[model samples]
Target: MDTVETLGKYEIKRTLGRGAMGVVYEGWDPSIQRHVAIKTVPLTDVDDPETQEQIARFRREAQAAGRLTHENIVPVYDYGETANVAYIVMEYVEGPTLDSLMKNQERFGLPEILRIMKDLLAGLEFSHERGVVHRDIKPANLMLTSNDRAKSRVKIADFGIARIESSSMTQAGTMIGTPTYMSPEQFMAETVDSRTDIYSSGVLLYQLLTGERPYEGGLSAIMHKVLHTEPLWPSQLSVTSPPALDAVVKKAMAKRPNERFATAAAFSEALIAAASASAAVVSPPPEDATIIESRRPVAGPVAQPVSVPVATPPKRSMTPILAGVVVVLLAGAGGAFFLLRPSADVPRPTPSPTVTTPAPIPAPAPAPVAKPEPVPPATVAPVPVVPRNEAVAPAAKPAVSPAMISDMFAQITATQRCAFIGGSVGNNSEAVLTGIAGPGARDDIRQTIASHAVPGTMQWNVANADTVFCPALTLLQSIAPPFGSADPVLALTLADNRTTLHDGDHIRPRLTMPNFVGYLRVDYIAHDGTVQHLYPQVADSSGAVADKVHEFVPGQKVSLGDPSAGQPGWEVAPPFGTDMIIAVASSRPLFTRPRSTNVETAATYLRDLDAAVHAVRDGGGTLVGNALLVDALAK
Candidate 1:
């Protein structure tokens, strides 16, 4: 790899990091006399369709972040291209990612965790309000910077996977998030809202308190646990944990989106309350009783509504009335007795005592000694024994033959099996399936497969796909036609009518656009994730002069005249796989600038293209395009 000293106005000091998308460098922006982190991916790598889409998405989110003015979010300052390399310049903060910090520290103290959660949720609330969803909010993407006055500040980084609420950039049914941090809905590949972030924040909080992730396993196992298993209470794992915190965790991680906190603000509020209650007698609420949610049936029969019986107040007792009457009579009798007794109480009597002594003792012990008899010889009859009843054993179920089990599995419908590909049963009835495609009732699928494989001996394992997979977008996302008319179509042809090409092979891309005269920009994403502006590079490599934006007329054909003509023709390069060539045409000028040395400089150009396409549908102007997929060298 060649080390470059400069990219646009910035001096690349050294490489900071590199990933599948591109490389990040510590750079010095000479114009501003400030340090910056510059990220760039070479044009040669962007040629592959996957790489193109990925890099494009990365730039798109950078542009989105550039629009935000939040202190908690990593800021995007500038975007440009130089020497066929696209670069995004961002604020260079000196800090370690939370992931790195967590490695050295076990569980964060309550104060530390509270501060982090508050700052994190604040960033999330700001981003969510602005309609930007940071689909990936893992610990690694959070930067913790220390300030002189404040303990630490959390900055959310890496908006490469973020999506604007209004933009449908992500195709439907695509799963785009880290599975461990993903919400149940995300795992199901269902539509996600900001509550998805709440669930992730809950997982993050859980980890901070317990020093372990809520779910840990292989991809499929993780997915299963995230979807179904409730995390162990933090108090159970960490002795220092406050019991009151469990309610907050339960609310944030409620399996259903509606069950989770309504907003990041709400989640933050709960955390603050729990932290403040550290000293009080906090019998906050029963976990289930806190929210008082209406009861819903869960894997049980629906209970019929019952009318509560009303009770009448008890009648006053009559025993007290009878007791009062008896007391009055007794009192009257005592008064009469007292009046009669006074007259005869004057006389009393006296008595005397006498004493006497007499008696002789006689001895007669010998007579009774011989009367003892031998009456112990009588035998008692044994009681008839009664037998005890024993429990009856249940009959054994008939064993299912291996052939019958195989046929049962064969009978499962493709839909019932969902995206399971090929399957086979081993001698011991261990069934292995090639892969599972989308999310579905995995438990049911396993049961169905087992029923047909070897009922009792059956075991299931996923082969190709270890986790649920989302379908890739194959069709070009293009502008719809105006006024119900057919969209302007563009087609590409290889000189040899072959989709695969080798290095040093020159191929002419024949062009078509919306049949009307309009501005056209022809671009190709190379396999290395580089964006190549093919046409109108006649006089300079940066781009064409202002007037050369192509205009299309019906039945007008465009082509690369010969291999010798460098402009509008592509010579295949190395490190090739799949590449996509797209032609965008709109009635308005798409590029605000005349030249883009690389794709980062072209982001605004692409963004304007998308806006134009959308604008045309709303009766503003016309925009349309077509895409061609070509295979370059395998490696």
Candidate 2:
């Protein structure tokens, strides 16, 4: 098949990608001075009004996804239809889908997956909030844009199968979703909600946490397990996998929507907690802990998105052949008619690790492992510290600031795509370090939280989520509305979601891997054997640092890293004081009126994440929208 010469003004560059819905193209927008992605759906093997309607749904998908504009959510630039083809114009993101990551790595480490989950959650939250349900939240739909890109670009893609959960899903009756990742209710073709997406997300995460699917079998067998069987706990899949992750997978794959998280943000928060716990134990590794996480920095060529034209999508084909409809879920029912079978024919679960592994295995959390041992390796550089005048030490800054906490909340909510705020709660096991813990240990918890915050990173580590109940209560009384409304998505109460481990059970959630020697710009330690530090050439991409600002005035012209004002050693005092980290918002809605691919489609949405950041900073602890809305995108 030869490539098409053109689509409208876009000169077809090449076929960038393809999916079940349509083909994507890399095209040149000669007049626009930039590259654009064109998605077009062509009429394929079909006949009759029924088939036409199915194609119509594809066109409608273009209409739906084109309206959204969040960073994590793909952006639709334009839409139109030819007599035989329909197309859409969009921003080409740069990276492979989370599916590629999982495929490449078998299972992603907890930290990387957590980061990916946050991005996906933010995009989903935005869509869900805007009356859309992705309907298919599999890894294939979630793209991983480089955080290092000039645009800090990250996005979720492929919303062709989305349906308006509030109404459309019922009539659509579309049998959508990958079997291994499909929520239990999806197989039944039952009424679904945001919870359905949650279930799928859990399944995908389970696969990411463990190299294997929770219940692996052929298509027919997997469907049977999805419909009527439970899954093995994540810990059971890999002894190195934290048991804490088990709850997350279970919650995400819960049979009932009510049993799952109410929003993508909630699930993300749970994931963050798991990561934090894992990090804590890894930092100062527990004795005899098995190696977990990677020691080397991540490496891969960033996948750049090529824009394609929007085309009329095929109508929703509500009926698809489900080959395994009655293989397992109804197996026992069939046996009732032949009740003469002996009791010995039935299978009884025995209590061996192998036997237990086949079912809902109770994977006990490992002794805190997966964290790298503290090393004098040149890759993990020492953190910089700021010296302060003892006279002003008490006034230097508060251990925790309301604004700092608020900023963290905003950034995490945006980036992690959770409506929840993450900080350490003041709680710890006073048992004086019984055995070991994972990355989620209190110490590693402090370090990871420390990674993002400077002076006042609030923490809920070494403590239950209730430890931060004071702030939770404050947020309830002062923040926004609908905290306890019918949606209940933003209920003020924070869910601990941590594994309820017995004493002596080494538990943590930090992901420690070796660094990459490729580039040494930044460093973090890991526990994985033979892990190395990885860094890219930042010297060329970034400008040389300017002189540090001596004053704290807003928009001051001073550059970062001022000469250690009075003393040269001041910068190395300690990592805790005067360190600054950038925070970007990452949260999005979990529900939407119509499912879509555009990142901006959520009920409460941000068309531009970069813009949202400045608005948030300017608002100074106030809502970033309203009068703050500018005329940039409107033009």
Candidate 3:
């Protein structure tokens, strides 16, 4: 076989790499005047079934990768086939593969490892939600755009064996994918799903953390270990690895898909929580001090008292002059008691003492006044009087005025249509901004808010929106609830792990309350601005309850919209755009009774929810919330 000069309009410059199936070339796109990587598979004897299947798979790769558009994914620009070869042009990245870097003994710090994992998981999450599973998720398939740890960016490649939900190119009994990174189900030649990629990602994460694979050896040996044995914990293998991450790895690589994290987002959240826990351990706060874990600095005046030790003065003998002075002070104190005594006609003002004394010397009594009213000695002697001229100081001023914050939010809303920005004052005297905005708008929004607010007094709970047209997300942001900075007590995920669904598609919401033991209320905000209560159906006599974990009993995980469980799922409809699913977990029931209407305007429902959340907070009950956004596309 001879190397060709060009494939379609792409002019081949040099061979980049070659594999058993095809060769990748560094090509130039004449029209775009940019470099592109052209991957070509040679076509021989098209009538042969093996050749025909290979060509089908080659085209499938193009279709699968073409459907995805994400920053972390290598996008396919075009796909074409000549008489003797088929090629796909992709965005050319200039860096080594993760496998090559690992082989070269690249040492990745915890932060770098986390960054890589986040990018990988984000790309996987997006692909999984769209019903595409990259059957081969190995270090070899992950490309980096830079060698510098801080600047390196991960892009997933090689979708030749990817299985799209709507495609039946791969059969269940077929064994495909790299052996070392294959999931247990994949090795067993069983039907694979998103969890399959999760298992492979777990392998990659393990390698990144411990500098070794969980199972290493020949095909049969690796299979046996993956099927029946547990690997050493990452913390054991790597001294710097946090022990908390061990459980995350175990869950991700569980033999059964049911035991794994349901979605990539869930897995990422768990990893972040573990990382945070590790960070807290490394830098513990001072004793007798309140620790407020917040995403932003708390604004306002803070009083930090400093203690100073004073030396005792040298002993001195008392003289006749000192004795005379003591007598004078005793006479003055007696006169003050009479003048400061409360009268029956006037109410007594509360005393505010400035200093505390361990003991007091007895003073000489003055001559008795004429018809003196008897007063309690305990009250008169201990209470210190404040001057009538001095008034109590007013509370500290906020970092930024409320009007200024409102004006900033208005400006942000005007420029960023997909953004929903809201502001409030926190208990710690900081100005808190909570909402969702697209990636492109986040920097501008942050800068705008920073200009009007104080540096240390501003906190944020604003999450970056994955898509630009998220109306339901904007609604959730507008109704921003005060969620604490601690790990979320509850989680809400779509059953399919999808953020988008086509019209007529059934939507299922899954709620997990790992540590929460209380009442649960789930609500659905449709694209059309209507809200519906999914849990605690109007006919049900009892409210939804999430039981806590006891000995041998796991925490609650409820799945809605399952017909086998006798629950109906919400179906996608017209007025397609973004929708939201919200789950509120509380120690007590949010509402006293079920909702009367089947569906109501989002404004009405959100108002009721706000009242319920307030009531729960006022009652001293625990409250936490989680929400997911879904895009309803027209089929």
Candidate 4:
């Protein structure tokens, strides 16, 4: 493992590079006498539980890239795993990476840029058609070289994290891609297809033209811009570009996948066309010219010009010449038909018929009017209407004040009120609810208002908490057991609201729970069906639990892998799937016993345990504020 002279049948010359996951070495295949690059993981990680998971993904990358065959894609020859290391052999591409090229300030010409992009897209098209998505498509992953004739050659490298359609390698809520070049869908943690690559390619094209990224800043800023901002045009970035190029960039980088080009092939065709059109219109066009044609016939013979000059002393009227010239011009042109056409061409008016005078007649007598029937009066009743969240006005006037409404909410069971936000009925009967926890929370509050307040007056705006709060709420519901009340609502806020975790990454969530919680427990469900109790072990006999309840922490921050729990903080492990975190709170001690097993091979506690912990159980008076362990965990 220490700078070996050879790996299998290949002779290692020197190390190419090293990344967090593995190492790349420049080697030679003795069998075919061809230069090959060997990629392998460190011998030390083959034993670590977390590293084993990454090695599996590393092998998956080999499988995904090995199945692909393209001129522009890096070719994989062989892959194998030893007792202590995993290695992949591929063709050694000769040239600097696109990242290196960009750093050298090597600006590419329009034609060269087009060619490189077309080849890159062609490779992506091949992979996508085969149901493989190269999630990470950035300058660092692209290899570039210029031939002796100045023609650029591009090869896409490092399909180490590519997603295969049939693989199921990644989880549903988990995101995997570089943030800078990621698509809007990737940022939203949505399932992606080939269009994601198209978005990244658009970013690359913009960078190629202007020598800068379209969106630049921190991860949050980039995400906000990607989701809600439109990038500047190439022409606006000081690049002398044509309108067609701007159109291509705008369409290719559209936030929605459907709005972008459907396939990489389509993206390539548009890119080629835009680049060519820009090249053709580099020069200015010529000015306009005018010509006048004379329609007079030359039938008359030439007249003698003798003494006519002597008669110039007599003034000539120029108005007649002008009128004659106008007439001649109109005749020669199409206007002559309207000015000199015969009467047959014009529409003729029809003649009216003659009328005879009528004879005198006698007048008739007027008729008498009948009496109207008497109408009966009837009584009408008003319909009682309730104000819901639908923006409709309530028929009945709201009787409760803002303080009264808040008090009524306080009376509801904490479970029922988990998703409720404090709301008030205005003097105009409009109800505005703030601090709504999630999207579903709006409906809960609306139902509560309809039951207790005037109908058609409640309006809850969830826009403020939606972006960050909804995702965690949805995640909690998806993984935890069903609960009765929304109370004991647990809001887990990640240090940056980032859900994506990697090897050696720590996840320290700031948790917000109800004030009545006396005891809390946290657990983790990994992708491999193993459940890890992340906090509050049942074996801890210390009085720390009682002390924690005595002190009410509004926003308690703790790492997932707290050393006190005898485990590393929320470090990412292998078999990458949608890993979940569960938290339970109760007024009394949990009845079930906690299990401690190997960190990597622990069996799931909820798998077949028919106890109260597996599902929500009514704790009766034992549970505080009507929320049981399941209700608390549901947060």
Candidate 5:
């Protein structure tokens, strides 16, 4: 090997680090006036088929990572090749890799651990949605950057073995990943997906929580454990670990892919939920119960008792009629005893004191009584009891009249290009108007709506549009008025209950059909000018069902894009701005013909949707729709 000074336009300054296959150098890009990291792999023998394949893979790294645009992902700036070497130029991230930190015995608090996982999952969600699966997800590839607020920001690097879903570069049955973090399926040489990354992330999380990897040993040992054994729960290893966190790790590292979280978003949500649960104080067991003490096993031969609580039955009072019957029977028995006084004298001789343990008394069954009249149902439904330490859904806000909100929204749409007003309206009116607009337009829209509606009802979630989203603003304005009202028959909300999101954020849309029973369809209108079908992913396969309608019953809540359900959630990506998710419930199928593709131009989708809405209306079929606007910003 010879000393190299440069590769293409990147001036190689000095060596930064060395890997198995290549050396990374801190380089300077003159044209961009910025620092870059140059990774160069030597071409020892170009004619060798193996070398040629390696070159292809090296280029594929650039292609796979280059397609992704996210704050948590280290972006590829350029790719070039010399006669004897090939190189990739990427953003120069100045920070320590998570692997290095861990090796140095650096400790991570719960907040820091969560932040790292959030950023890592966010990056994976973005890349996975774009059809790239990072086969190798390890601490070595995660770099930590400090933000202006001195918070750690994670950036994922080294997509060398990342497999693009649409590409056939990597063949199936090729075992290519770190054995320590490889998922069970990966070890079996099976096809991998986003869940593979999830498993690896779980391993990283386990390490973070317990200061040790779930499986540690030689290759064969790790493989056997990952395939057939379950690691000790996080709580078992670390006393400070919460039981909820143990559940999260177990599910994330489930042997089967289907058992794991369906999407990175769901995994992230579970982590947040676990944190919340761990923070909550656990309630004590009820009184009138016998409880045995048990303790979690530690690394010793000490024996501990298993804890089990037994409930005591409540005592019941005898009814007046039953008590009178018992009294009459006792009086009859006393009279018989008086008649047989000789029998009592014979028993007195055998009355020697004998001590014995009394048999345990069994609880008596209640005597049946005459049936009483049925009671009418209560006006308000009784709240169902939730077990201690379990999550409780927030109570739904009081319903508001849609007509008032609709009229107020109509006034705001007269001028603003990217404006959407949603929420409820009434004495307890609460609405949020979100979109991309300038300061003047936002103020004007807010002021106009605030005057007509309640002063505090309107919440403005507006942001200035960047160059990428400027054109989308015009398109949004041209679209027809959103269907349904502030109070919709089918309600939709983000699973995390957040309206403001950032790059790599997961979008889990939850739908509730409280008072409606019909087929449902959900479409995501993105800031990138594309409308993607989010529900009933495809038409009926056998054509047995004409409408391909997915039926939704009243009082049922559906979490769309949940990976645990074998569906991927929508992940926020580039062209950050405002986006809308439209949900429609119809008595019949809205579109009889199957769509050629799930995604189409916004104009085409709206045109089709408008026709469908009108057709349903003309046919006198029940139809309802609702829209939720979210602001997607750069992290």
Candidate 6:
């Protein structure tokens, strides 16, 4: 086996990265007097014929990547097998791994991501020509080094799982790559070619643009989604994603492998085009007026006319002037007859038979010279309603002060974690039950919105940024009676209670509570499909109870108040406790077929939960309480 400390003459300095195949180590090579990346695979990895075959496959990948000596491709220097280990030596580059970059930095602008995308494409093209496919392309396997953060050069790394056309390694039906970024074909164990890598790069690119991963759920859940579900478009995350980028991303991640880019080079080219198209959408840079002025010849300013010579006033002939006035008066009267009269020019008056004028034997009027004719007046159009995200009519007044803006954001974020998780999945307006917007997430989303908005108000551009800020500022503006800015907390509390819920409200995704003590499920009546999931709930859980649903299953923790089959934590908790109560009209959904495995049922159950939510929102009056109170009154 190739030892770690010194691989032949190279002294291993430290571990660079580790994987199932081998460990990458930073090593000192005396011959080159420079640091080099050395990978050592111990014989234990391929102790038998099976591993040995895989190692042979590794050699083919190394060769394919080795031939790709581009700046973005990790260049290989040597490859060999010792005992049960196979080792690869390559040039050492000083930069953070793409994985690290992503982990540290949540997102990058389109321009920055495109630069990395292009570099990756060129390297991929170099490998694909030799019929090599880097099936496991993820952020961790990429490296970046640069002076400018936006223009950092990216290098593709870890081609250990590279698939070559002739290689007889990596058997079918065996899941190998990261499921989050894996393409459907890889999940199916189908023959993966270059297109598979393209799909993965698309996923990677999406992640870089949106700090969140494209798919959600556990490993198995992700695999199922990758194999069956379609990802939401990047534009959904934020409107900032250019339409062109969205198209390219969609094409690259198309469910049908054939629909994806044919090659990495093709993907890169498409990316380039998308970026160019996005740039074209922006206005051209302003031209310098100085240049325009220089081009124009200014003849020295015209001299002002001094009273050089005033012409003598001309005298008019009295008889002709008087006759001319009479002629003008007659012409004006004659013109008014046709101009204001409702003859042919205007519609006839409704009242008829009042009087009829005799037709005059008039001159032909030069036979009425025919002209092209005038166009009809255009009808007035109603103005369109401005979208909530778009700027409304210009602000009546300047924005609130920065201090007020900060206070508003802090107010909402302060109580971010102050959310409820009393119901099961589909609770809290039918969102995923058990979502823990825990204080952390609540604080994060609130702060994120404020961070974008406060500074956003400083500019007139930025879509929806000002809108979001306006409403939030308005909420803050109404916090207290006129002069309550001095005490921001009371104002915020007042605003929180009075303001209608907007999308930005700190309505955290409810996480399942640890203790749902003393809750008893009174009953549930659910159909095959309905948004109203749980209703008329009661629980024994004793504490500062939010609603009756919490009292139903005191020990059973629920994420949201809503409950359904696909609900994560709502399943029959393995062995149902005799003491625990989960009352339901029908446990199984009425319909056998669902929209998407369980979406119909999820929506159905969310509806059932409306009663509990209403009770909480309006007043803590259970359906049972109303019936009992009414019965007492009747008696």
What TM-score against the true fold does each predicted structure earn? 0.45, 0.44, 0.45, 0.45, 0.45, 0.47
- Candidate 6 positional error at 303, Å: 85
Model 3 agreement with the true structure over 1-635: per-residue lDDT tens digits: 23678788888999999988788999999997999999988888888998888888889999999999998899999999888889999999998899998998676666778889999999999999999999999999999987665798999998999999988778698988888899988877888999999999999998987777776544543554466556666764444466688999989999899999899999999998887787322321122211111111111100100111111111111110100000000000000000111124322222212111112223222211011113221110111112211122222222333443333343333334444434454454454554444555555645544432322344445545444224433323222222222333344445444456676665655444535456666666664556666554453333222122111111344444432212223466666665555656666777887677556777777767766755665455655555555567778
Report lDDT (Cα) of residue 248, candidate 5.
93
After superposition, which runs of candidate 2 have C-alpha atoms over 4 Å from their true positions? 44-50, 147-154, 165-173, 279-635
Ranking by lDDT: 3, 5, 1, 4, 6, 2
Candidate 3 all-Cα RMSD: 30.9
Task: Please write out the lDDT profile of model 1 over residues 573-620, one tens digit for every residue.
Answer: 555555545555566556555554534323444555454444443334
Q: lDDT per residue, candidate 2, 1-635, as tens digits?
A: 12677787777888888866578888778888788888887765557665576576766566567666776788777777666667788877666766666677543444556666677788778887887777777777776565342334347676766776444533535556677787766765666777787787787777766555565433433444465446546654343456677787888888777889999989999887876675221222123322211110001000110111111111111121111010000000000000011133223223222210122223223321011234231111222222222222211222333332332332222121111122221222111111111223344434533443323323231111111122111111112211111110110000011222221211111111111101001111111111011111011112221111111111111111111221111011111111111111112211212212211121222223223432332233221010000000100
TM-score, structure 2 vs. true: 0.44
Model 5 lDDT tens row, 1-635:
23777678878788999877778999999997999999989988888997887788899999999999899999999998888778999999888889988999766656678888999999999998899999899999998875331476999998988999888877676878999899988877778889999999999998887676776544543554577557667654443355689999999999999999999989999998898777432222222211111111101100000111111111111110100000000000000000001121111111112111112233223211101113231121112222222233222222324444433344344234333222223453444443334335555655544433322354444434433333333322222223123222444455444556676555655544535456667766666667667655553344321223445555344444432211223466666666666666666677887677677777777667666755664455655444555667778
Q: Tens digit of lDDT per residue, candidate 4, span 270-336?
A: 8777766654332221121111111111011001000110000111121111000000000000000
What is residue 458's positional error in candidate 4, in angstroms? 48
Cα lDDT tens digits for candidate 6, 289-373: 0000000000000001011111111111111110000000000000000000112222221221211111222211121001111
Please identify which of the two predictions, 1 or 6, would achieve the higher TM-score against the true structure: 6
Better of 4 and 6 by lDDT: 4
Residue 467: error of model 3 in Å?
60
